[model samples]
Target: MQLNIFELTSIYLYITLAACAFYLAIMFFQKINRTRGSGVDLGPIFGLGFFVLFFGIVYVCWGYMHYFGYEYDFHPLPLYKTGILMTYFALIGVVFFSEKIIGKTKFAFTFFSIGCCVYGIFFTFTEFDLRLFTYITNPITVAFILISFLYFLKVKTTGEIRKQMFSAFLCYIGFLIFFLLDIEGIKALLPFPMEISSIISSIGVIITLVYLGTIFLRFETFTEFGWKDKLRELYIIAPNGTTLFHYSFIRDERNQDLDLISSGLTGVEGILGELIQSKKKLKIVDHQDIKIIFEYGEYTTIALITYENLRIYLPKLTSLRVKFEKLFQDVLKDWSGRIEVFRPANHLVNEFFG
Candidate 1:
């Protein structure tokens, strides 16, 4: 039997969502394995998988209904609006747990999400109307797009700001396509099937999933520690023995190695001071069951201490030191000594060596 456009589109969308969800689920599992002991929060990445999985289930249901020739208005399953609302909720979770936004901005996003959820629930109980659903969701989607764009514009962090913004934009445009398809007269403009809405929107979602996958691949928030010993502390010190930035992976206060490292470096600048005489780029000190690695730059010095014999990080330390000096050359020269000027160095350290 020849298939109608609606049936074809529904089948395509169902297959696409299901496939994308399956792929993401596998990636998420591997990501967890990859970051097992790195103390990295996997919530945001899990949310991404859940978001696609939730919508995939919804699309399969919708596809089954369409395949059986059950009209949405008459179908017993009132899943359409609820699915979209929950999808938005999932996206909100992604944004929240990603640690991309914090402070008052994160709070504002949370507040807006709650408002939308409450509003969507009210209408779902009362009318469950598609038009009302679209109207309510459109504003929320647009708000997400705008907020993401604003974040991308305002922030200078190393996180995937552009990818996040573009993903939100794709979602908004996908919803727009879905909305336009349901309009009274817009259907006449397209000679194709009304189900083109599903096709277009599914394409948008597929693109979004692809983008997210790329973000996942490029993600370096977590590092695999094959052994029990792990990197415990990292610090950048200025030429004047000033602490420019400090990061500690060891959470326990009892582990005073970080303090000792700082104090020892402050007094003599042992490895840092030796850089001029030895003319060496990297130095390694294995002292008292800890390995301290130093990478010297023209204006700044980088120090890393780890319990493990992780010799592979020496090159990374050198690269970080070089980038730090180059990126903060002007500030290093002026040296007002206010630590705030080097706040950005925190992000650099985390991104490059954390």
Candidate 2:
């Protein structure tokens, strides 16, 4: 079977629309489940879902128009423009409402949504005049992509959200690059046809959609870690002066050896978890002045205490005892309060006894 470029483009667009519809439906239901009992705002899910549905339908219509060669009015009147604006308003309402409801970053969502709204309005007016609209919307879209990319990059400091945000950032950059390359002026400079540019742009869009879908599906996983994890770690390591440990030592409580604290240090928690597990003894020197001491092998590492958690991993075992002490001292020197580190007076005896 032979297929023309137009047919292939339509097929791709249809597939994209179908995937988007399924994604929106799933997210809508998930949001509904959360807001079922309480008097929570359903605007975000409703708005987002509505926009997705509407956009999908519009694309389908466009596809049909292209396939059939229908002389459809691409441009709309002022009233129709108002209706398009309403769609954007719905999107904005949903983004803001959902951000508040879900306790996500508001600024990021607001900027991206508003950018989309502005672009939507631009497209609405320029439908009848592609040349004018192309000039305006292309630059505007590129600017939005850059802004969104930066925002995602900034919010990605936390390890949990970093991967998804990075993926999103790549998508935006990809789109921006494609648009820049596909412009008539740029195409003239390039040897290859513009079709290659479209393919690359489409791939970027696909990646962006996948990342967005992953984020929606794994909302809990991408969210920042609450204070509970820190509190729990602190509670467990209270007996030990060293509240923080290397990432290699922390183990889940289930696998922890009741008789040997070191056993708990070997399991899979981050650096902080391992430190709490590795320490032989823990004590609070003064309640008013929080301080922690850990006895590891033949050295005692002391630290002035703070709520901040610490996780470090020393990959090598040879001469680890000295390395651990030096690391602890380095940390102490950076802090404001006084901290001390001392080798055990009877090092040989301590080593022999242990």
Best by TM-score, which number? 1
lDDT of 1 by residue, 123-167 (tens): 555333644665666566556645654554345232244454456
Residue lDDT tens for model 2, 192-293: 654454445445545554555455445432222221122222111212333233221124535433224433332222355566785534422233323232
Against the true structure, candidate 1 reaches a TM-score of: 0.57
Error of 1 at 202 (Å): 2.4
Task: Give the worst 10-residue stretch by lDDT in candidate 1.
Answer: 220-229
Q: Please give the distance, in angstroms, between residue 256's alpha carbon in candidate 2 and its true position after superposition.
A: 30
Cα shift from native, residue 334, model 2 (Å):
27
* Candidate 1, residue 194: how far the Cα is off, in Å: 1.5
Instruction: Pick the lDDT winner.
Output: 1
Candidate lDDT (C-alpha), each:
0.60, 0.43
